[model samples]
Target chain A: MSERVSRTTFYKRLSRLWRNGDSRPLLMQALVVLVVLLLVVWVINNTMNNLEHRGISTGFDFLSQEAGFGIIQTLVEYDESHSYGRTFTVGVLNTLLVSSLGIAFATVLGFLVGIARLSANWLLARAASVFIETFRNIPLLLQIFFWYFAVLAALPHPRRSLAFGDMIFLNLRGLYLPQPVIEQGLMPVLASVVVAIVTALVVRATIRQHRLRTGQGTIAMPWLLLGVLVGMPALVWHFSGATLSVELPQLRGFNFRGGITIIPELGALLLALTIYTAAFIAEVVRAGIESVPKGQKEAAAALGLKPGKVMTLVVIPQAMKVIIPPLTNQYLNLAKNSSLATAIGYPDLVSVFAGTTLNQTGQAVEVIAMTMAVYLTISLSVSLLMNIYNRRVALIER
Target chain B: MSDQMIPARKPPKQSVGLLVWSKNNLFASLPSTVATVLIVYGLYLLLPPVVQWGLLDATWWGSDGTACTTEGACWAFVTARLDQFIYGFYPQDHQWRANVFFFQLVLLIGWLTIKATPGKKWVLGYALLLMPLVSWWLLYGGLGLKIVATHQWGGLMLTLLLALCGMVASLPFGILLALGRRSNMPVIRALSTAYIEMWRGVPLITVLFMASVMLPLFVPEQVVFDKLLRALIGIVMFQAAYMAEVVRGGLQAIPKGQFEAFGSLGLSYWQGMVLIILPQAMKLVIPGVVNTFIALFKDTSLVLVIGLFDLLAIVQAGLNDPAWLGFAVEGYLFAGFVFWAFCYGMSKYSQRLEQQLHQGR
Candidate 1:
């Protein structure tokens, strides 16, 4: 009888523990935490053992060592004597250069094609659809290869280069355009431009306040702002003795000299990234514009608004809410896809820092970790900025 | 009034039929007419040369570079090296194994597509469980079959295998991660979130590099990773994060009432998810899964950067051949066409599936 009473009491205690408020969940969570910690510990321990056995000491100190390889393209000052750390910065800047240019060109082209797809003209709409489908469906790598090897490489030599008057030249080497040489006085001109911008902003704000108070729209303020922005820069350039000159490319020996040279690698990467991404962006833009209700367009038209005004006032603003999120995603994708430059020897982050540096130093862990961190930082920053903009544009309900 | 009405009899010949349609569509405004003219002129300048190069003046059959006598595309190179392009360095005799594997895949797809297939759940479960093993046997060779190394594997075969295995392996892990992310347990949520974000934040190339170069250093000294296996691991990890996001989107779409209903039935957490929630969630996410698969298919091309002989890599190899040095254009175009066809077809199918599934909602 005593044994049975003890068993019953034990069971009662067990049941009480199970029924305790939130303790079961807490226990389960703790168990999960324990398992995760153990797994991480195991992996790290194994890695350490492996590294020790392989005689590869893992640390980030190698970043300060000299990198002895030449990069084809460098956005900042870099050479073979520079440390790996500087090479990393150079790689990152090159990546940024390609991504930013690609984004700008892709956006402009994408918007044009997107609007064309909705054209009343049947041929224009069909052409836009064909363009989107043709470029997007092909693998971007193949497109890059085509641009690099088939099209650009097949260009004539510098002596017989294709030229547009005296301004631009294209050949097997690259596209050469006149380089703008800004003289010393250009600094003051640039400063005046900044001042004009600030003044214009203040003037615009005051005009907005005046219009809000008096119920009269100040239309001339926009022209005044534009005038200040353009006129100020021109006047300063003229009076401040800023001498701006264009140095045209001259064929020298085997290559062009004096002008800005766009290497074939950059041209191929830029063109492929722009054309490929533009197709997807076009689709996003089309979907955004279509998502706006037909009733809204009709309502705007009924309000005596011109077709262009209706598009600007009613369609675009509403469509942007749907467009911006996907647009940001496309931008991120283009940035990531720029890493494909390694395949074509574009000296991107992965190619220069991760590929060549890792190979030379045999410090795979440190090189890869740093490269991944750079990308992660970029991705997160882009997301945070876009999210803030998205929130601002999002419709709020009372 | 009758006389005025009698005058309105017949419309002009140009104001009817195709002419009228063209007038409304192509010549409605000055801008439209100008755009039409420019587009037509552009096509006029572009289409014939492409057609002549691709079809008319192209060499249809030859064995060497010398066979391409004309200025048109050297399709002869693609034809001559077609076997290498398709199978990479796989032994010609063992190419039959790849064919059999493809056939099995087709059969499985056919069975899945047929609406009236009986015992579908059991068949699908069995196939899902057994297909990987069967494929491994067919690919790597075992049990009286000649042993074929992964390095010998390349071309479309390797691309398909990598994508299929990655998609299959990632799906369950993605589901678990997605569940953990939404779980009440804080530790599990944090772990899942970190894993997803870390993988998603980095480019697949970096992940590939880590797997190819660093994975060896992570494992025990005696253990070695095959190049294909390393690339596969990277691909699976990268894809799982994307898959988890898609699955999470599906999970968030499910109503909270379903969870409560499962709770009222005295179901455990796993039981509720498995029986009540996941089925609806998975159904809603079929399109997303297919889209991810398409992306994975395209990404398999990146294996070339890691020195894997995928389809793109094989084509590149062919381009490097001394005999076919200048025929890169044709080889790349052929490979591009193949990839485009597959990706485009799957995307279209996904759209159809999405539309069908959407109607049920």
Candidate 2:
């Protein structure tokens, strides 16, 4: 085939290309792309050269050094002596704590408000509208400040803290609540939970198998609960002492000394974020609920299902498909907005890594890079989780 | 039966006009009647104090903080510090030049926005060139105006400058980013994704911190960048990612027919995008664009975190003035009202634009 190839054939193709008259546009396009590419390369090269001249070493090496900063709220034990990597973990955990709490609280409030917005009761609908408008219109940072400086700061001193029963205390600092202490015998209770879960799984499988094989099935929930509550607890109690204690918070010299103290900074940040995000989430929830056809509710009712069950099983399940994507957006928003915590001295990820670290180390490039990486990782993980849920809820068909 | 049917008539009216309307709308049921009563009473309780504080008890004209000691809004503090708030530490006499610069900028912007104006392209080009030059002269005062450095820039002037500059700089960058995201080439798409996600994932405060602190360290040891310029850069970079995503949503909503028609018409992608697709997409996204603008306006308040005195910062600074001590609530309320007005107007305008566009469609 190579031997048979002729100069005329190649020339014909080349001539045909010129004759086709598409070359001019193609050349223009190519030139435009080339110029743009050259400009980008020039900029990048200049930046790199600038960095080199300045003696600024760029990379991930600084992550191994001592952080030299204290985080306020940490899940894992941490101190100023910890490595930057560990400090970063602390920051990440604090971020997760706020976002998760915000998500849970926002979802509950959002659903209530959203349903209220669509309620037949005029007062309920107006109240929901008022809540959405008032909260959503104000800037979240301002709300955080309001909560921190105005509301929380106005609370009485610890000695005269607002008493919420015998187990909890409230002051300018935050809500202080009792912490439960698990005793040695609690192992049996935990073991029972594990047994219960396993038994439930086994029962579920058996019921499905029986339904398929012989059109017969038994409710497995009671048996599973009995197995866990009776079997595991009895076995564990015989082996060890089982006891429990609750330590109630009490006002001391200037602050609560025992139990868990939710600092005002955390409270303010969480409250602002949850309330602000809940407004948007309420709109999302309202839209989701309204998107469900009336016929579905009617059909459920026709099947002899109670109104509450109809909502729990049929309406919510379908509405969730609509709810989840926007809910994910709101989740991301809450996470990002939590950075406002820095304004009030909540030592979140941004405050610790981006704010304090940059101040101390003066390694702006590396510290900023590290901060961005942390946020990016969190955002991506949240997106990934939501996407998986989205896939599961999506309709499947041949 | 026919006589009975003929005798059937409308029910007698028990009420008329507002009474009937109120009965139907405000007091439709027992609970609604209670809500109506409570709401009216609540309004009566809340509004009079607000009116008194804002208007009746306010000090309108004063030279200093001494004029605002009463249990009312410290308008005199705002008026006395108005210059400080508007131009920050910028020189006093040169403020007139800034005012002139602002008026000219507004005139030019108005010219561009008005459809009847000819030479749209040339006016746009001039605007693109003149804004930076005039603002530089107005702010830095190098070209015969009087050089006032960025440190002196604060208050409404600072806010307006940041919003305008950030919005303008972000537009082109965001458009490119959006195009890159939608590009057919995998490498280009990946690069765009990385850039957008990196910026979008983090909060603007982090970015600002980087700009103010890390950026100098990244460049060189002794090379100093202007703090205001750095903040502006941070604002632009952070906002561009969000703007790109918004633009991308609009881009995606354009139907395949539009693309195919452009293709069949032998139009290049850039040509089609610029001349046809973008206009339609942008019109469709007017509400989203306006919402983003409102968001950007609110976000300008965050500049306080980095020590720049925007409106909120100025109010915060006012709270510390010995005469106005313990007036944080009043200061914040004033600032909040101003912000609310601007944002509310933008939102309302967007809603109107949505209706306008819908009708046009």
Candidate 3:
């Protein structure tokens, strides 16, 4: 009897613990933790053993060593003498430069083409659809190759460069444009414009309060605001002796000099990235626009708003609410895809730090970790910002 | 309304005429008319020269670049290297093995895709299990067949192999990760989320770099994987994260009632998942899975970074050949067309599947 009672109690306790929500979940979680810990430990052990056997020292100190590499194009001051750390900075800035440019161009083109897809004109809509289908279906890497090796490489040599109105030049090497060199005096003029903007904002806030106190005063004094915005900047510029001059690219040696030089690699990468990403963005934009019910547009028009205003004030705002979440994804993809620059030797972060540095130092672990970390930080921050915007948009609907 | 539903009479001939249709569609307004004219003018200026260069003035039936005597495209390079582009460096004598492998794939894929075909279970089993073994035995070769190293594989064959293998290997992993992500256990969910986000945050280039560079270091010295296998592993790891998110979307849509019903039937978690939950979730996510497959197909081109000569890489290499030098335009056009055709076909099929699934729902 005693044995039976003890067995029953033990079984009862075990079954109760298993059936309970809290204990079972906790036990499952603990088991998962244990398994993961074991796997991580095993991996670490193997890694340590392998590293030791291969005789590859791992540390971030390699960053301070000289890179001894010549990046063809850099957004920052970079040379063979620069440290690996400086190469990293240059790589990051170049990546950002291309990504931002690609984003701006893709957005503008995508919106135009996306809106065109819905045009009443049959030919225009078909053209837009054809573009989206063609670019979207092909891989971006192949497009990059087509642009670089096929199209750009086929351009005439620098001696017979195609010149546009004596300010822009295109050749096998790159596209060159006259850069604006601002004089030292331009600083005060820029400062004065900033002051004028602040003054205008202050004036508007005071006017809003004034209107609240007295019904006679209107809140928007367009004339006064316009004068503050434009006249102040103009007057300051006239007095500040600010001079801006164009620095035209001149044929020097084998290449252009003294102007903004877009290396062929960057150009091809930008063109391919913009065209490829724009196709997807266009689809997203079209879907967002289509998601806006026709009844809403009809209602807006019924209120006597013009078609343009209906789009700007009513339809676009609603469409944006749907467009942005997907737009964030596209932006993230573009940023990540920018790493493909390595294939074309565009000196991106991966090419410079992860490729050159890792090869020179043979520090695969440190270099790859840092590269992955930079991307992780970028992706996380971008997604975080977009999420906040998404929340605000969602909140506005209520 | 007539009781017999008076046969919908054909509208007046004037209304149905092409002139009226064109008026509404192409010239509905001044801007529309202008747009029509502008597009027509643009096409007029562009189409003829493109057509001439690509077709009329192009050289064909040539063995080398020198045979091209025209001022237009020299398609001779593509013609001469067509076998290389299709089969890579696979030995010419045994090229029929590759053909046989492709035929098997066609039959198996046809069985799944034709809709009227039966034995979905058997087909899936053969594809997921037996197909890989057969492909390896045939392509890599052993067991009474001469051994062919993976390095010899290149061209469109490699591209398709990488994509198919990546999709097949990553699918089960993606499902597991999705399940882990939606698990009630915090550790599992957190780990799944971290794994997915880590992979998603980086580019495939970096992942390939890791696979080619660091993966060997993580394993024992004697356990070295082949270069192609390493690249495939990287691809699977990268693609599985995307697949997980797609599957998770399907899992999230599954109602709580299904869970409760499965539990009430005295089913365990795995049993419920395999029988009740996964079947519906997988059906719901078939379109998404296909989209991922399309993406993977395009991404296989990136294996060039790791020194694998996929179709794009093969074309790129062909560009540098002294005999075929300066024919970059023809080389790229052929490769681009092939990629475009495959991707477009898959995307269209995916759209049709999505619509059919939606209609069923």
Q: Which candidate is the best by DockQ?
A: 1
DockQ of 2: 0.30
* Residue-level lDDT for B72 in candidate 1: 88
Cα lDDT of model 3 by residue, A273-340, tens digit: 99999999999999999999999999999999999989987999899989998988898899899999
Worst 10 residues of 2 chain A by lDDT: A23-32
Q: Which residue pairs in model 2 clash with each other?
A: A185-A242, A364-B214, B141-B146
Ranking by DockQ: 1, 3, 2
Tell me, by lDDT, which candidate is best.
3
DockQ of each: 0.73, 0.30, 0.72
What TM-score, over all chains together, does every model reach?
0.95, 0.82, 0.93
| Candidate 3 regions with alpha-carbon error over 4 angstroms | A1-21, A196-231, B1-14
User: What is the number of backbone collisions in each predicted candidate, taken in the order shown?
Assistant: 0, 3, 0
Maximum-TM-score candidate: 1
Predicted candidate 1 versus true structure: per-residue lDDT over A1-398, tens digit per residue: 99999999998886786678577777677878899788878778888887777687689888889988899888788889999998899999999999999999999999999999999999999999989988887878888988998788889999999999988999998999999998887899989989999989988888888888998986347688999889988898888888889999998898889889899999999999999999999999999999999999999999998999899889998898899899989998999999999999998999898989888888887889999998899888888898788777663612
The pairs that clash in candidate 1 are none
Tell me the tens digit of each residue's lDDT in model 2 across B153-194: 787777777877787678778889998899875666776877
Instruction: Sort every candidate by lDDT, greatest first.
Output: 3, 1, 2
Could you tell me the TM-score of candidate 2?
0.82
List A-chain TM-scores for all predictions: 0.93, 0.82, 0.90
